[model samples]
Target: MNQPHPSEHYPVIIVGGGQAGLSMSYQLQKRDIRHIVFEKNRIGHSWRADRWDSFCLVTPNWQCRLPDFPYQGDDPKGFMLKDEIVEYIEAFARKVDAPIKQGVAVTRVRRGKQDRLEIRTSDGDYTADHVVVATGGYDIPIVPDYAHSLPQRIAQVHSMHYRNPGQLPPGEVLVVGSGQSGVQIMEDLHLAGRKVHLAVGSAPRSPRLYRGRETTEWLYDLGFYDLTVDRHPLGDEARHKTNHYLTGRNGGHEIDLRRFALEGVKLYGSMAGIQGARLEFKPDLRKNLDEADEVYARIRADIDKYIAANRIGAPEEAPFRKVWEPESEPLSVDADEAGITAIVWAIGFRPDYRWIELPVFDGRGHPQFRRGVTDAPGLYFVGLPWLNTWGSGRFLGIAEDTEYLAATIAERSASQRAAA
Candidate 1:
């Protein structure tokens, strides 16, 4: 594609054509809004580049639906593998006829006068009245500084680099971070015949399902997953604590620490430090486990109250009822015996706004925006973690967020047109 002149202007330009970007594009198309999406690679690069060979979305096909495209598959509760998701996203772009310039990597985004944005890219420079940073949140993987001191022999890989069992070395693997990625990686490595030791952390206790239905189904029915940042009282609190949102896996499978125990995946307390070949760990898992249990109990009580107030009937109880049970005991393991050969950091991800030279970011590096409008007028952000809700940044959840953002963009564009 030929590079446009630096002075050329587009009505709207979006960076990073992932799920969030695509969704925003779909909404714009529906509104007959002219926009261009600049993608670093082909559409769905993140899903295509993700290393998990056997990776399946935790959310089922039903919950994976986007704004204009609904997931059409045999299993509503079945997890769509990585490849399937990539194809779905590509198809969505085509179906909506979104104007996408693939393989164009954005180098920097700066605010221009009169609510304009200056976007510098590998292909060329372009100005847009509105810019949506739909880059998504998981662009960067976080590895703690403590990991730097590990012995030369101990291999360390972030979860993003992890593909399948074949990529791991023989013997035990130490999976750090008890988040969904860490737990899932530990499960996969263990199932692949490698001894695994999981380092626990402060993780939210989420039920796999509720009332015999998929947890996602219940959440959708109860409008829990539909929560927006505007309506959620705990949005600031939740955002302050965690940057990631936990979703339920498909096929009614619940992820609980007890399940790891049942599968013989050795669990360890929080990792203190790693020196040479030895990894130091806290002796007690009681405090962390207890805290998680309490949180889960409070969530359960809230759900129960919601059910009673709404008079919702309980369906047939599921076999995975044990997930709802309280944590009974603290589990610990010796890092030496577990044969943790590699430490896979599945901790979490943070925003990389270094390339964005806008003065809209707060002290913590998150963009300053209300809805999708930034302090610099035409500069906008969409698909950011908790941009507008508990689920605003999620797959099915982005529809409402995009609609709101697109309307705001249109309003701003109309006002500009009137002035012109």
Candidate 2:
């Protein structure tokens, strides 16, 4: 192992150079604060590496608002593709002129001597009066243990590594989970004419358009984007909930698993276990579908009420009708019988903060904080899902969260200078 050089010092050190970290840097620059951002890879690494080729933002481009930068494109209502999204973030990074060190991975962060925080990175050692952890929650791809039970012929890839249908062997593909990524990847495969099977989870559905307007616009008008975790009915539980599944591909539209079923895509309940050559699934296919539809209907109802209350002029549309229903749920599927050659695990990712040696974490390893301000002095967090509001981790609400943390950090720095 290479020895770390003499520790360098900075007034503030930020870990992770994604959207959240970049936004925080922009705020600090506006306040003339001295800070350095450390990124494990180049800027917009996640967007350029993790997402599939057909990926696009589910939200409109108009919501792509950084601190002082907003989407200046003409098609604000249109969703930006994966490449475009990367360019947008890259542009912001250039505009901010952030003092960022790319390809420097922070391996550990712990309390150091003299009441400062020590940051251990691949490059060298450093200490800062204040530290901000901007690493987002999606750090590690999660795969079930049962996946190892499959035969060697069965190829498996996590959603993060999955690029396209051609990346897999030429055979039927099994997609696990019905979250945003799972459903979208399934559609990507189906559109490519691959024989696909899906294990539907309990992720809710979101409407793309209602009353001739984008549903997101309506929701924003209703102040849904401004709803904070504390004020939400489900409280913090809302943070753990899976995001509603929808698609921004080929313009925006709703994703109906029932319609997928109607088009001959095999659908199953939540994956339970794997036995020999058969994959077992819980008999909850019908239940999961029904519940998803219930949420779909509820959202439309809310929009209808909003339209009526505001006396808005909109065309009346027909109520939603079930296009298809499962006659019987299959408990298990024989992998060989179905000619399944590959599996895409889109279940989701787990947060890995093992490097953080501080005691400011919860039982589940989640950081304990009130809108990025932790109980530990000089320790802060940003870019977490639902850190303050529904848009906390998204492009829509990151500016507000980062600005708040910057102000808090600046005030604390001023107070410390006075004391010294």
Candidate 3:
């Protein structure tokens, strides 16, 4: 290990080495801006470590556009699995020569003593005219507090730690939280011949393909991704909503809870708690499923209208039919009674910004930034959820958002030099 240095300064500093951070570095590098990116681990480490072996990007390959190297593979419409994503990111770093200091973890980002922003890292302290928190959104998997109440006999795990079925115990799996991760993992376990039960939450479900086109293409063509927070009716709710229930495995298909129920996977309401060895839940399964179906219906209606008004012909698609329901109100079951030997928390993730010792965060600990610009001077944010548009947190959206932040940083630098 190298000795720690003190007071080294730069024009800009970016935290994280994921796609967001690399994109910001590329943008700054293009303009000859002196900036450094500090990653707690190696580049693409999060995607490599946090994701399961079967994990693939929900977004299509073509939509993963970086600054210089856009995805131009043979399968533009296909999804890239974990390995491919890491390879693409590594190639981007090599191509751009992004000045990323790997293994340097940022401990604190606060206002410096003078005019610059201060950053304390494992390597050393750094001051910069601008700091881009490009850490991206999925930082930590959010397991509920009540999960600790589960019996010691029942092994518990989060989706982030789950690699395969063999890794779990020798009985049924209880998957909590019905978002993207929950459904995907449940399906993986079910196909592996392990009986699985899922606690369906309120997160909406989306079809992999809407009409003849991929759901992404339909939404992209409809300008849904370009919709800003100001334009959305749900506003912050729309911006901060958990990921919809969808899958990118085996060429993508809908992960309908009702379908899962039909396929022998037990369905229950939102997980309430664990009373000793028993797992408690509500009976809102039908209500929750309806809400998800409603959203899907609205989205399809909009797409149909667009095709009709534009005189564009599209194939008539069959509407999703829900024919299966739980026989009666789901009863609280003892862990062993349900044959559940392991419980997996697929409750999604929340961004970790604990290192930022600043007052710029909201009550929820999200940054107080508008379109990537913060209230504090020289303090900027990029790739945060809905910083500009619906896709702001995505790979393609991060690239676009970072470019804007870089331009803003440059303008501020030029003004400061002029004032000096």
Candidate 4:
């Protein structure tokens, strides 16, 4: 009665409660494997926490699929908002009866005695034969170094903390990084009557719908996501590529930065550096705009070629608008002169795996893994960009990757049992 029972160990421990973790848990549960998912916050906390109130799925509703669940709404093509995404994940966890330990944030994951993995969490210590870091590689916000150079009087917030226009200070807003987040927030704030200045950067604008079909349809048919990371033409750039510019506002549409500039959102080229109260920018506004248009044309050309080759019947082509219209004066403007009082860093995120005491990262600090399997025999990572394919980091690809990892875990566990 005086001696306490030993802590029971599980075969696998998953370190996130997002879609990736839940998807993996569903597959493992189906295989009757023993595993536990430890989440820092509640299930789907990432979506519930960081995303703006108006944020919706960049992909269509039908693509939001889990193992045992899928988008079942009447509007299959409609986008799901942030709250709906959280609800879907919560429902998925319940449906699979996922063994999730909510509010248990894993502080460390390192090799323990006998090579078993020890995961230290806020709740308690847990050991597992295999550990899966399903923490979808985008937790750490990536703000530019020059952000600190701005006067401390100006407020700065990353996209993760940004919610609505109301949350921002009542003044001109400067949105850095011209990717999806930057463009969307800039548009929303501008429509809300706030003066927004968007710092132009490397971003590819894609049409929301093309030839009466979702652009996603053409991508799926073209097998764009089927290309493996190792074989992608972008080479190492494949891992750190920025998201293409598109917005779900107004039921999804092309987000044109050039048009935004004409519509009063003062556009500046890539931010060079900060000098006292003046912010300097690289004079590449036209260059960046042309590059984005090139990408758009490439996409359209590819789709049209596919349509012609397949003899696919499609609706009449929608009139394409010019991506740019020259302003009477140079589009470049000074942040301080624009009366900017707030700077929101929409620059993307990087993965924070410092807690993982393992030598399995690439030169870029990304995990070294083929698909989800790491070289560390018992350690694995999931839901990372290009882990297997272009889609590996997305909802449609998570289930596929999870299925493979789950099977691998089950097969390896069986072999271990036999040897024992």
Best by TM-score: 2
lDDT of 1 by residue, 281-359 (tens): 7754656555666665565666677778998887643242433322433343444555666789888888888998878
For model 2, how does the per-residue alpha-carbon lDDT over 19-110 read when each residue is reduced to its tens digit? 89999999998999999999999999999999999999998899999888999688999999999999999999999889999999999888
- Candidate ranking under lDDT, highest first, comes to 2, 3, 4, 1
Worst 10 residues of 3 by lDDT: 1-10
Comparison by lDDT, 1 against 2, better one: 2
Query: What's the lDDT for candidate 3?
Result: 0.85
For all predicted structures, in order, the TM-scores are: 0.89, 0.98, 0.96, 0.94
Residue 375 accuracy (lDDT) in model 2? 89
Report the C-alpha lDDT of model 3 over 1-420, residue by residue, as the tens digit: 123555889999999888888899989988889999998899989789988889998888988888878995788888899999999988888887788899999998888677778888998888988899877777788888887777788899989899999998898999998888888899899999999988988999777787688888888989988999878888766657877778879878877788778889998889888887899888888888889888878878888898898888788988767778667767588887778899999887887889887788888877777788988898888877788898888877877888899899889899999999
Instruction: Give the Cα-based TM-score of candidate 4 against the true structure.
Output: 0.94
Q: lDDT by residue for model 4 over 1-420, one digit each (tens)? A: 112544458999999988888888988988998899998888777889888989998888888778768886788888888888888888888897788888889998888777788777887787899999998878789887867777877788999999999997788998888898888889889999998877788888887888989998798899987888889988657878877889877687888777787788887787777765677778777777878888887888889999999999987675566756545334345556778889888888888889998889877788888878999988988888888998888888988899999999999999998998
**Pairwise lDDT winner, candidates 3 and 4:** 3
The Cα error of candidate 1 at residue 383, in Å, is 1.5
How much does candidate 1 score in TM-score? 0.89
Q: Global lDDT of each model?
A: 0.75, 0.92, 0.85, 0.83
What candidate 1 gets wrong by more than 4 Å, as runs, is 1-6, 113-115, 230-233, 243-250, 315-338
Candidate 4 wrong stretches, greater than 4 Å: 1-7, 316-334
For residue 37, give model 1's deviation from the true position in Å: 0.8
Q: What is the lDDT of residue 387 in candidate 4?
A: 82
